[model samples]
Target chain A: MNFKEALESGKFTVTAEVGPPKGTDITEMLHHIDLLKGKIDAANVTDNQSAVMRINSLSVCKIAMDKGLEPILQMTCRDRNRIGLQSDLLGASILGVHNVLCMTGDHTSAGDHKEAKTVYDIESVQLLNVVNNLNSGKDMMGNELKGPTSFYQGAVVTPEANPVEPQLMKFEKKVNAGANFFQTQAIYDIDKFKGFMDFARKFDVKVLAGFVVLKSAGMANFLNKFVPGITVPQELIDELKEAGKEKALDAGMNICARQIKQLKDEKICDGVHIMAIGMEDKVPEIMERAGLL
Target chain B: MIITKKKDPNNILETVKKYDKFFLIGCSECASLCGTGNEEALQEMTDFLESNGKKVTGQLVPKTGCQTLGTKIELKKDKEACADADAVIVMSCGAGTQSATEIFKDKPVYPSNDSLFLGNMTRFQMFDERCSLCGECVIGKTAGICPLTNCPKGLLVGPCGGMSDGKCEVSPDVPCAWVRIYERQKSLDNLDEMKEVLEPKDWSAGQKPGNLSTRSEKKEEKK
Candidate 1:
């Protein structure tokens, strides 16, 4: 079943994201896709993830589709203006692509390309509206189209964003902008997530708790120190530290599995979006350990 | 105010080399403070041009360069000298340069300064960009700070994941704008106000060649 159908089925769905390689070499990426076939409801192909230059997300998604995997086209406003975004949406539809995750991507300065010009011609909320407009057979300028799209619109939210009110406000705006589902930023503190869910449940949208698989104590510490809207609790870091260098990856997977199990067991959200970063191969193990597979 | 910086003297000199006589206009407002089109700057240009074998017919620093009608009225006193000049050199921002262009359609207009942005003079001659003229304002929500101008990313809901040690990823010297806003909001105990993600700005409002009338002039208009 497609991601939209899977979301509506009320059964907890699993989605995984993949970052396209920087150069033309797709051997590793295609292998990753083969590994994830039938393992996830949908695979999100990231567009220039972290503002770093990579293979286009659309190209990667098409590759995934050719290999018989449902692809979620991650579209960001950082690199494209309205014209580019609308054209890609039309192209995605024509190619039989289904899901599209709209987001205001990481700034160019954050990535390897510090001198790149970032175009936020529209933010994530407005991008969602643009998708909705395209789906309705009209463009942002109210121009009609020869054929319309049926993209499953998705947006990202940060539950742990300090001054959570703005995040909540943007969440409401995204929902109002025709976002069908939300895949949030990496969430570690479950109770805080539950609090965010309490407010999120009021809207009629699917909420996917975002899990950034922890690889080691140092990684967790890095995220805690550097990444915003992500608070890796001390105990989880301590757990990874106790596991030490030899078994840290296993320990990290176990920690991710435990969070997934708890989120699933408690029915805290509609589903979980596993962002394994470069470690996409470990996602299935995380699922299996979580008793999901 | 609209900040401006003087163009390279050599470049301006090269443009006016074909013309023997030139008139100069400057603004006493933003241009004066920026040391671009002030009375002192105009006099310096006059001396420099005179030494370089060019006759400066007349020079005047108008009350406001962008107020086209007012500058025209003030320039009437220098009408004979202006009429003798082959070209008019404006020593203010782009807007003020364009004002001169509008006033003297018959003569070629040259700008001596490049307009930068709407800014505040933070200290003596030091300026800080405070707005992008995005046409829509959201400083009310961001503790009177403009993320569009201050944040390198222009992120409305930011302090993106790249922030480190309360500094922007782009430069360590530049403190993250969102971090400043958060700290300001926290100190003012107004953090709750920033919770709503500012909706995307109505970019059309900021479209190029923006024009609007506030209706405050309605009383005069009806007269």
Candidate 2:
């Protein structure tokens, strides 16, 4: 089933993220897609993820479609103005890529191109509204669309954000703006996630917990220190440390699979979205370990 | 007030290399407070120019450099010096530079300072941007904290996923605008307003080349 159908069917859906290469060599990307063809409900093609320029997400989405792997076209408001954003959405719709994950992307200064001019004309909530407007057979300005889109719109939330109220408020705004589902930032602490889920259960939308696989103890420490809205508990770090450098990757996979299993078994949310970063080859193994396959 | 920073002296020198003699203009308001257009700065620039083999014809610290007509009247005394100068260097914001440009139609006009943004001086010489002039104001709904200006992404609804420890991801030192708004609204017992999804901003309202007149409507009506 498609992502929307899968969500509506109340199945424990699984999705993954695939970052398009910086250069034109799509060899690794295609291989990743091939590895995840049937494993994920939909693969999200990142739009210049972390503000670093990459192959456009739309082209990769089309490639994923051609490869028979469903693609979620991740759209960020950082790089495009409303005009460009709306035009791209229409183009994506016509190109047969429906699912969109709207996000207010990382600031340009955070990326390799610090000198790049940012165009956050509209943010994530507004972008979700734009998608809703397109799906309703009209553009943002209330102009009629010649051919309307039918997109399964998604948005993101940071469940473990320190100041959770504001994030929650934005979450409700996204839902009100017609976000069908939400794939969150990397989630490590399940108990903390449970609290967020309790509040999210009131809404009609679906929530998919996010997991970014930890490669080592140092990686976990780095995430805890630098990355916002993500916290890797001390115990997980200890487990990786105990696993040592060579086996840390396997230990990280075990941690991710265990979290997924806990989230699924407890019905914390509808699904899970795994961001393997560059470890796409290990996703199927992680899934198999989680009893998803 | 409009915040500004002085351009590099070498870059400024390179820009006016063709001109040997130049007149200087500074603002007594925001630019002066920013130390980019004060009397000391003008004297410093004059000395730097003279040392670099360029002549300083004259200098003026206008009460308000952007008050183009007033500045024009004030420059009447310096007409001889201005006419003698090969160019005029404005040591103020872009608006002040344009004022000099208007007065010196034939002479080459250049800005010595880059106009940064409209901001308030939080401390002595410390400024923070408080408004983006988005035309439409949503601070009433946001408990007077302007997210459109403070938030790096200008997120209207609330903070983005990048907000952590009540700080914005753009910079750890910068507090998340929406968090401040949320807290303020909560303190006021007006958190219900936070739930209202703001409609998309009409960007055309703040479109470029914005022009406005606050003159009394009765004069136009009488005409």
Model 2, A40-109: lDDT tens digits are 8999999999999999999999999999999999999999999999999999999999999999999998
Q: Rate the local accuracy (lDDT) of all candidates.
A: 0.87, 0.93
Top of the candidates by TM-score: 2
Candidate 1: tens digits of C-alpha lDDT, residues A1-293: 77899899887889998789989888899888988888888899999888889999998899899998899999998898889999999999989897999988888877898888789877777788888889999998889999888889998888887656545666887898899999989999999899999999999999999999888899999988778778999999999899989899899899889999999999999999999988989888899999999
Evaluate residue B119 in candidate 2 and report its C-alpha lDDT on the 0 to 100 scale. Answer: 93
The ten-residue window of minimal lDDT in model 1 chain B covers B157-166
Interface RMSD, every prediction, one decimal place? 3.9, 0.9
**Can you give the TM-score per candidate against the true fold?**
0.78, 0.97
Off by over 4 Å in 1: A112-117, A141-144, B6-25, B40-60, B67-90, B99-112, B120-207, B210-223
Per-residue lDDT of B1-223 in model 1, one digit per residue for the tens? 9889888888989988899999999999999999998989999999988999999999999999999999999999999999999999999999988989999989999999888888888998999897898987989999998988898768786555445566666676888888788779989999777666566567788889988766677787897
lDDT of 2 at A238: 98
Q: What is each candidate's DockQ, to 2 decimals?
A: 0.24, 0.82
Q: Grade the docking of candidate 1.
A: acceptable
